[model samples]
Target: MDKLKGKGKEAVGKLTGDRRKESEGKADQVKGRAKDAVDEAGDRAKGVKDSLRSDDDR
Candidate 1:
């Protein structure tokens, strides 16, 4: 969502020649990607923990 919003803002900034908006848009995209990475890591950790629990049952 943030990435999509950033893309739109970046496009608009380019059309309107606003340097600040363009930089902000770029920052938003980076933030979105970082959030996605953290979420993925958390999910992987949960999966590992679940597997460990199942192993204990056996």
Candidate 2:
């Protein structure tokens, strides 16, 4: 979602030389950064879950 928004903003900025478009791109980039952090945390959670499941199997 954030990535899509960021790409759209970036493309629009490139197409148009509007200051608002550039600002939008900056905002989207920040959103993307937050999304990346969330994804990393989710991945860590999944890894812990998998490790626990494997231990149970053993």
Candidate 3:
């Protein structure tokens, strides 16, 4: 996962005193979180759509 990789990179950056790597790692984590949010929203939408279809059939 991006978050996991980011954590590793952040840790290594801190140990090696590389600010760029640390920033990149932080950015990666944010991106991963955003992606997760979008996926969750899509799933929720699908659930709503399915429920509506079932209700219509009934």
Per residue, candidate 2 scores C-alpha lDDT tens digits across 1-58 of 7767877887888788766886787788898899899999999998888888865586
Q: Which candidate has the highest lDDT of all?
A: 3
lDDT of 3 at 51: 84
lDDT of 3: 0.90
Per-residue alpha-carbon lDDT of candidate 3 for residues 1-58, written as tens digits (9 for 90 to 100):
8899889889988999999999889988998899999999999998888788865575
CA lDDT scores, all candidates in order: 0.89, 0.82, 0.90
lDDT of 3 at 19: 97
- When 1 and 3 are scored with TM-score, the better candidate is 3
**Could you tell me how far off, in angstroms, the CA of residue 12 lies in candidate 1 after the best superposition?**
0.7
Per-residue CA lDDT of model 1 for 1-58, tens digit only, reads: 8888889888888999999999888988998899999999999998888888865575
- Tally clashing residue pairs in candidate 2: 0
Q: After aligning candidate 2 to the native by TM-score, how far in Å is the CA of 30 from where it should be?
A: 1.1
Model 3 clash number: 0
Off by over 4 Å in 2: 1-17
Runs in model 3 deviating more than 4 A are: 55-58
